[model samples]
Target chain A: MTQHTQPSAKALVPFVSVDNMMRLIHHVGLEQMLRDLAGYVEDDFKRWELFDKTPRVASHSDVGVIELMPTSDGESYGFKYVNGHPKNTSEGLQTVTAFGLLADVYTGYPVLLTEMTILTALRTAATSAMVAKYLAPKGATTMAMIGNGAQSEFQSLAMKAICGITSVRLYDKDPAATAKCAANLAGTGLNVVICTSPEQAIEGAQILTTCTADKQSATILSDNMVGAGVHINAIGGDCPGKTELAAGILSRSDVFVEFPPQTRVEGEIQQMPEDFPVTELWQVITGAKTGRSSAEQITLFDSVGFAIEDFSALRYVRDHIKGSDFFFELDMLADPDDPRDLFGMVQRAAR
Target chain B: MTQHTQPSAKALVPFVSVDNMMRLIHHVGLEQMLRDLAGYVEDDFKRWELFDKTPRVASHSDVGVIELMPTSDGESYGFKYVNGHPKNTSEGLQTVTAFGLLADVYTGYPVLLTEMTILTALRTAATSAMVAKYLAPKGATTMAMIGNGAQSEFQSLAMKAICGITSVRLYDKDPAATAKCAANLAGTGLNVVICTSPEQAIEGAQILTTCTADKQSATILSDNMVGAGVHINAIGGDCPGKTELAAGILSRSDVFVEFPPQTRVEGEIQQMPEDFPVTELWQVITGAKTGRSSAEQITLFDSVGFAIEDFSALRYVRDHIKGSDFFFELDMLADPDDPRDLFGMVQRAAR
Candidate 1:
C-alpha cells in the first residue's frame, strides 16, 4: 500500500463515501448546495430531450423493492442502485440506501463512484423545490411538511432556499419524529411550528408537502384537507400502491410530474385512471407548458424522483469535489500494460 | 485520517480490486480456480428456478453498449455493470470492462464490490468448460481455439482442467495474437500448436472455441469448416447482430444456450429465425434435457453470458476470499447510529 504502488490512471475511479459527502455538504453550506443542486436539476430538465430515459428497472420482493435507475446524455452515463424497505427502520436500518456511478460513454470507463444515500436526500428535496419553483403559488411563504423524518429538514431548507419559504409547519404520527425535525431545523433560518394533527399543520400554508414513508396507500391528507391556491409537494408516495394524498385531491389539482409514464405508476397520480391527464414538469421548465394559470388554481408537484435528478446530482458531485478533499481514488478497473495480455499482467504482479 | 476513525461494521464493504483479483487467481492456481468456479456455476444452474431472472437491461449507443445484468436469490442480490466497445483495443484499451456488487436482500447492505474485468474472463471460461463437461464430445483431447485474445488462455486452461483436454491449436486473424497466446500458455502444460489458418487450427480437434471480438456477424467458421462430433463454444458473438458461426452450422447442430431468450437475441442463434429451437444449458445440467446424444451429433454451446453466471462468479469470489488477504474494507454505506437520524450523523461529523 505504498504511495508509489498507486493504480494506473485508467484503473482509478474517484469515490465519495457518506462521510465525505457529509463533509462536502457542510463545507459548501447545506443551503448553498441545495441551491446549486436545484440549478443543475433545472438545467438537465431544460434539456431533458437529450437524455435516454427508461422506467426504473425494479425487482420487488414481498417486503421491499430494489431498483436500478439509469440514464445518459450521449457524453456520460449514470445509474443508481437503490432499495426501499419500510420494515428496515424497525430493525435499526435505514429504509432507503443507495450508491451510484458515473461513466464515460465514449470509452465506457467509470469515472466516479459515490454513496448516494445522503445525496439522494439532497437531490430529492432539491427536485421537489425545483418543480415547486415553477408550479408553486407566487409569493409562497409557508409549507406544511407532514412526514417529520430524515427528509423533513432537508425539504424545508430546500424550499426556503429555492422558493423563499420562510416557515414550515411539521406534523408526524410519531411525536419523537416531529421533535427531531423541529430540533434539526432550529437554526436553519426557517420558522418551525410543531403541530399535533395534519389538519392543523396545513392551516394557512401556501405549500403543503406530504412525505410520509408508508408502503401502503394510507391517506395522510384526505380530500377535504387540501385547499385551493396551494402547491402540494407529494414526496413519499414513490412506489406502486403507496401514496399520500386522497384521490379527490388529485382530481381537483393540476398535477405536474417529472415523468408521466413513471408518475402514473408510482406517484400520487397512480390513484387516477391510466388516461388521467398530467403535465410533464420538464415542459414547464422549458416553457412549453403552463404551470399555474390562475391565482386560485391548485397545483401538485407529484415528485416520485427520476434518473435525471440523480444524474445531475452525480454530475454536480463530480464537478464540485474537484480540488477538494471529499473523494479518494479507487482502483476499480484492470489496466494491464498490454490490454490483451491480462494473464501476463497477473504473472508479473505475482513477482 | 485518524486510526480511531474506523467505519462501523455495517458501513464497511469488502472490495476486491483488479490487482487483488489477479493475485487471488494466482494464489488459488488458475486451472484449479477455473475448476472450482465451474462447480459453482453448475450448482447455480441446478437451482436456477430459485433465481429472479430478467433480460439484461441494456443501453446501446452508436459506439458501444452498456448493460446491467442483475439477478437475485431470495437472500442476496448481485449485478454486474459491463460495457462492450469492439473498437476500443485499437486505442490501447480493452474492448470490455466490468465491475460488480453483491448486496444483502434483507438489509440492502452491500456485502462485496469487486473489479469484474478479470473475474469475467475466469467465469466465462469456467462456464464454457462446465457446459463442455455436459455437452462436449467424450474423450476430447484437442481444442481448436480460433480468435486468440484476452479470453483465449483462460478458455484453454479451463478446457484442460474440466474436460481433460490436453492440447490446444490456436489461430487468430492476426499472427501476433497467436504468438501472444502461445507465449502466455508456455508453462500451462497444454501442448500448444500455432496454426496459420482456422482450417489448420481445427484439424484433429474435438472442441472448437471462437472468441473473436468483432462486433459484426462475421463468420469465423463457416459451415464447411465445422465438422461432426465437435462441441462448438462460440464466445465472441455476444451482442445483437454479432455471430461467430455461419447459419448453416447452427441449423445442423443441436444448439444449447445459457438463456434461450437472451441467446436468441445475442448468441450465434441470433442469425437464426425467432422460433429456432435451442435447449437451456441449465436444463441439461439438471438432467431435465439431454446433452451430447451421439458422438457424431454436433453440439453448440451458444454462450452470451447471463446474470446467473456472474451471480455465481460473485458468489464464488465472496466465499473464496474469506480469511484471505485479497480484499480490504470500503466505507461505502452510511450507517448512522440512529438509522432514522442520517442528517444527525452528518451534523455530528462536522463537530
Candidate 2:
C-alpha cells in the first residue's frame, strides 16, 4: 500500500499546515521557538549575498492586495502567495492568509508546502524582535504595543522572549482588543498595562511596536509622541498606500528597511522622497552599515516584509519536525525510473 | 476518530505532481481536454476586462529562468510557477516544468493545487490554436512546425483538431527529435513529412510555427522564407535574450500579442523597435479588431505565453476533478473560528 502512493525517484514533499505549525509551537514551547527563530532570521541576514532577491510582485485591487514573493539562493528556491484584506475579519476570516513552497534548485522539485498564516505571524514578530536586539540600547526592558489586534499578543511575546522586554503597555481603538491582549500577556512574567491613547502607550517605552491592520493611512504613532533612544517596529505599513508612522517620524530617525526598493514603495518611507537615505537591514547585519548611531539616537525599522525571513522560518520548521508526528508526505515531484518515460507513467495510469 | 490527526486549524495543502498531471491527461483523454480547455481560455479572453492583468514577473539566473504568472478576476485568482531551462534535457529533465494554484480572492485560500508541467503543454498548444481560429485564414489546412521537442506533438494535435490542419511539416536540428515527433503523430491522421531544413518546411504552408528552445538570438525564420498571407505563430522567443525570427520578417507583418507590455519583453517582438505597433489578442477574439485582413497581408501572432491561459487550464482542472479520485485538499488558508485565536491553536497543539 505504501509503495503505490509514493514516487519512485524523488523525495516526498511534506505538508505543514497552520494547525500543525501551531502544534509545533506548542511542542517546542513558543518562548524557546521565538528566540530560536529570531536567531535564524538574524543569521540569514548576515549572509544576504547568497540570495537572488527581487521586490515582491504585488497586484492591488480595490479591497485588498495580493502578492507573490519569490527568491532563490542558487541552491534552493522559495515563494509565498499571500493576500492582505482587512475587511476579511468582518466576515469572520483573517486579514491575511498564506502558503508557500520550498523547492530544490537542482531538480526544480518542491520539497515542502507550508501554511504561512501562522508562520508569517511568528516570523514577523521574530523579525521585529531581532531588529530590536541590534538597534535597541543594552538592557532595554519596556515595550508599548499599539493596535492590540490579532498580531498584538505575538508582538508582546516575541519582544519579551527574544529582546528581554519585561514590561508592556497596550492601546487600541477597541478597548476589548486591548483587554484581550492584556489578558493573553498575563503570567508571562511581564508587567502589562492598558493605556487609553497612543501618546500614553509610547510615553516611556524603550521599544514601540505597531502591528495594526487597516486599508487606510492611519498614524499609529505621531512625531511628538516619540522620543529619543527608542526602536520603532512598524509592521502594519506594508501596502502601497497604507502606512503606520507619520512622515515626521521617518525623518527624525535612521530608517532601516527590509528591502530598500520595496520599502520606498510600500513602507512608511513612501511618504518620503526617493533620496531619503534608508539603510537595508541586511547591510547592518552583514556589517556593511551601522545600525545605531548613538545612545540618544532614534531608530526606525520600516519592515514591509522580505523573502529571507520566510526562508529562515521554513528551515526552522523543517528542522524542528524532523522526528515528530506532525510530518506528512505529499506527491510533489515526479518519480520516474527512467525520467524519459514520464509519458509512460500516464499510459500506465490509463491502463 | 476523525480528530486523531490534531484538528487544530492547520491547513492541509494537496498537491498533484507532474506525473499526476500527465495521468490526469491520460485519464481524461487529451483530445477532449484540448477541446474543453480551449473553450475555457477563449471564454476568459472574451471577458478580458474583468481580470487584473499585469505582466508576469520573472527571475532570470545564469542557467535558466523562473517566472511567476498571476491574474485575478476579483472573485477568483490564479498563478503559475514555471521554469524554462533549455539545457535541462542533458540532466534528464524536461525543458519546462510548471505548477500552479487557484484561490478565492476574498480569503486567499487555495482551493486547488495542480501539476502544470503537462497542462502547460496542452494549454500553450490550445491557446495557439485558439487565437488561430480567429486570426488564421478560415479553414486553414497545412502547418509547418520548425521545432520538434516535447511540445511538438501537442501543438500538432491541437492545431489539427481545432484549426482543421490536414498536414504538418516537421524540422529539427536533431533527426531523432523529428523521428520522435513523427512517431507521436503516426495515428493522428494528419500527413506528417520530415523536412531537411526550415526552408523546405515552410514551402506553401498556411500556418508556420517556430518553437525552437534556444537561449540566444536564432534566426529560425527569415523574411524570405515566409510568404504572403502566411499566419506566423511565433512561440519560442520568450526571454530577454531569446529571439526566433529575423527582424526583417516583423518589419513587414501585422503583429498581435496576448499583452503588448509583456510581449515586447518576452516575445519575438523583443527584437523590434520600442514603438512597433501590436494589437492585444483579446481585440481579435472579441471581434473588436478585424483579424487576417485579406489573405495577402502577413500576420504574426507574437505568442508569448500569458497568465490567462494557465488560469483557464486551472479552472478546467478544478471543474473536472470535482467528483474524481484526483482531488486532494490543501491547508492553504488558516480556518479559525476566531481569526485572532491562531496563538490558541498553537497553545492547544501542546496538549
Candidate 3:
C-alpha cells in the first residue's frame, strides 16, 4: 500500500500559464515572437495536406459559443478549447478565452498544455500577416486597422514585423477601443492614426484589416469604400450570423480562406453562397494556386481561425518552452507503477 | 502600462491534480465517494433530456485513439479528453489516461480542470453499479468480475458500496492481473474468490461484469454460460470492433444502454444490427420505460461509458472542491481591467 507516492515523469504535462506566456512573449521580444509564430504557421500551411482536419465542434447557446478544434499531423495531435461570449466584456470578462493541448499520436499522451487566449491573438495575427505576404500588393507599407478591439494591436504589430508595414490607420465604432489600441501602439514605431470612420481608416492604406467584435452581421466594410490592388484581411466575422464585409465587397474580391468548409459557415464568405469561389490559403502557400496575379485584383483573406493554426502555435510553444523556464509541469495524468494496478495506486495513496 | 501584474480572480481556474484527486477520494472515503458519484450519475440520468449529447469526437491512428467527449446541461458545460492505447501497457504506460474541464454555460468560462484518469475509473464503476441497482436481479449480492485489470477493483468496490454486493469472484487470462486485483481487495469487506476460469468465476453469481482491455472483439461471456435470471454488466466492449459478449448472448437478453447513438458504435451491441431493440437507461431512470420486467428476464446493461456520466463526475468534483484545498488555481484565462484592452494587458505585463 505504501510503495509509490509520486507519479512518474510521464504523468506530468508541461503547462504554460497566461503570465508565463506573456513572459515568453516578452523574453523573445513581441515583434520577434510574432515573426517566429508566423514562420511556424507558414511551415504547417506548407504541409497542410498531411494533417487531419475537422471543422470545430461547437456548442452554441443564447449568450455565446464554446468550441473544440482538433487536428493531427499523424505524428502529433492538437486541440484547442475556446469560448466566445461577446456579452462577457460588459461583465468584466474577456470576450474570448482559450487553451490548447498537444499530444503524441503514437502514445496518445498529452505533451503540452498552454494558455491560448494570448497565443490565439498572436496566431490569428500571424496567420493574417503570413497570408498577406503572398496576397498583398508589392511595396505595401500602410494597413487600415478597422475595429480597434483586442486584436487590433496584434494585427498592426504583425504587419509591421512580417509585411514591412510602417503605418497603421485605426478606427472603431467605439472611440474608447480605438484610444486603447492607439495607446498600446504608441511606442511600437508604427505611424498610428486615429480615424473616425471606416472610409478615413482605409484611405491610402495598401492593406485593410477588419476586426470588430460584434455578434451580428454588421458590414464594417462596404463595396464602395474598397479600391482594387489591395489585400483585405477580414477577421472579425468568425461565426454564423456574424460577418464584417458586405456581400458586394465579397463579390468584388477574390476570397482566400483557411479552410473552405469552415470559412463557408463562419467567415466573411458566409455572406456569399455555399458554392462561392474561394482559394485555399494552403494551396497558395504550396504554389499550387496563384495568390495575387495583378496589381488591380482585390484579394481578401477571409480569416476565420482554423484548428491547424492552433496546432502550429502549439508546436511553436512546445518547441520554444524546451530549455526555458516559461512553463511548469502539471501532475495531470495518472501513472501507476503497474499499468494494470491503477486501483492499487489509489489505494496506496491513501496511506 | 504597469497597472496590472497579476491576473484577476476570474482568469484563474481551479485545477485538481492527480495527487489531490487521490487525496480527495480518501478524504471522502472510497466507498462513500462511489456512492455519492452514483447518486450524481442517477440524478443526471433522470434529467438527461435537458443535456446536449453528442458522440465523442475521435482521432484515431494505427496505434491508438484520442477522443473528446463534451456535454452540457445548459447551466454548466463539461468535456473530457481521453486516450486509449492498448499497446501502451507493454511500454510501461497506462492503457488509458484522461483529464476534463467544466465551464459556466452563461459566460463560457471554464471553472474547473481536473485529472479524469482516476476519476474516469471511479465514475465508470459508479455508473455501472447505479444501473445495476435498477436492472440487476432484486437482492443480488454476488458479482462475477471477469478481466481483472485497472477497472476491476473499482467495479467490485462500487458494486459493494452501491448495490449491496456481498461477494466477488474474479478471473483474468493473466494470473498476475487476477492476483493484483485480489491483493488490492484484501482489506475490503467483500468475500473475494479467485477463479482460474471464466465459467468458475460466474458460479452462483447474479451479476456478471466483463471489463477486459482488448481493443478487438473477444467474447469473454458466451450464451451457454449465462442462466435465465442473471444480469450482465458488460463494460469492456467500449470502442469500434470491440465486444465482450457473444451475439448469441445479446440475442437472448434485453439490452439497456446509455446514449443509444454512442452505444451502437462502441458498446457490446455493436455486434447486433442497427435496428436492435435496446432500452435507454435514462428512460428507465425517469420511469418512461420498464427495467427488468420480471424475475426470470435476462437484463443486459451494455455499458459503454457516456459523456453524461463524466459530466456528473465533474459536477461532483466541482461541488466537493469548494471550501477545500483539494485544488490550486491556474492562471489559464486572459483577464484585463478593460476587457477591450487585451493588448494593453500584455503590454503592461512587460513592465
lDDT of 1 at A152: 89
- Note each model's CA RMSD in angstroms: 1.5, 3.1, 1.7
Between the candidate structures 1 and 3, which one is better when assessed by DockQ? Answer: 3
Which lDDT tens digits does candidate 3 get at residues A100-164?
A: 99999999999999999999999999999999999999999999999888899999999999999
lDDT score of residue A215 within candidate 3: 94
- lDDT (Cα, tens digit) per residue for candidate 1, span B183-209: 999998999999999999999999999
lDDT of 1 at B113: 98
Those runs of model 1 whose alpha carbons end farther than 4 Å from true positions after fitting are: A1-6, B1-6
Worst 10 residues of 2 chain B by lDDT: B1-10
What TM-score would each prediction reach against the true structure?
Answer: 0.98, 0.91, 0.99
Instruction: Please tell me which model should have the higher lDDT, number 2 or number 3.
Output: 3
lDDT of 2 by residue, B1-351 (tens): 013233333354455655466656767787778888899999999999899888887766777877889998888889998877777777776667678888777666577888787788889999989888887877689999998877777888899888899999999988877887787688779999999999999887889999888899999997788778889999989888899999999999999899888889888888888999988888888999887889788888898899999999989988887766665665556766567666655554555
lDDT of candidate 1 at residue A289, scale 0 to 100: 95
- Which of 1 and 2 is the better model by DockQ? 1
Candidate 2 Cα misplacement greater than 4 A, ranges: A1-6, A194-200, A318-326, A333-345, B1-27
Displacement of the residue A261 alpha carbon in candidate 3, Å = 1.0
Candidate 3 Cα misplacement greater than 4 A, ranges: A1-4, B1-4
Clashing pairs in 2: A18-B10, A18-B11, A19-B10, B11-B331, B12-B330, B12-B331, B13-B330, B13-B331, B14-B330
